[model samples]
Target: MTKHIIETVTFRLKDGVKPADFAKSATAMNAYVSGCTGFIARRLSYNADGLWIEHIEWQDMDAAKAAAAGIGAPEGNRPFLSAIDGPTVTMTHTELEVSVN
Candidate 1:
């Protein structure tokens, strides 16, 4: 059976970065990821506490891992990575074992 992979990342923006700029950067990153093999979907959201969250879905863990290896290399991803406060970043990936709906 094929396993689904979900990658979640929580982060805060660096000082001096604006939300509008970050949004544009994220859009670029989204486009880049969309072309990757096995990419399913992606969502960007924020909380009232100033944390930004990114949820990405992949066909499987291998695809997710492959994409991760190039996260810092693509030009389109630079803005998104540079805008993030590195120290505040937290990321995790999991395989879907159960689902209801």
Candidate 2:
């Protein structure tokens, strides 16, 4: 069954780097993630901890993994990676118990 995957990526901006300089690349990455086949929905957010959390919904776990493998540099994620001090990416699968919509 289709499920939601919350992929959180933490980016510690370089000593003199600002999130603004990397916004475009982040946006591009998100656009690619949201446009992939089997993508149902997505949301990206920033936290005071200096990490970006991207929640993505895919048709299934297999689809999610396939899409994630494609989420690296080839998709233009190189800039984002270069602009960060330290970054970590992880994905979590969520089972919905109930939904109003």
Prediction RMSDs, each to the true structure: 1.6, 2.9
Candidate 2 lDDT score at position 31: 62
Each prediction's whole-model lDDT (CA): 0.90, 0.66
Per residue, candidate 1 scores C-alpha lDDT tens digits across 27-59 of: 989877998899998989998777999989999
Alpha-carbon runs more than 4 Å astray in model 1: 97-101
Tell me how many clashing residue pairs each candidate has. Answer: 0, 0
Q: Give the TM-score of candidate 1.
A: 0.91
50 Cα displacement, candidate 2 (Å): 1.6
Pairs with steric clashes in candidate 1: none
How do the residues 15-98 of candidate 2 rate in per-residue lDDT, one tens digit apiece? 676767777777767767776877877666677767766667677777778887786746477887677665354546765445
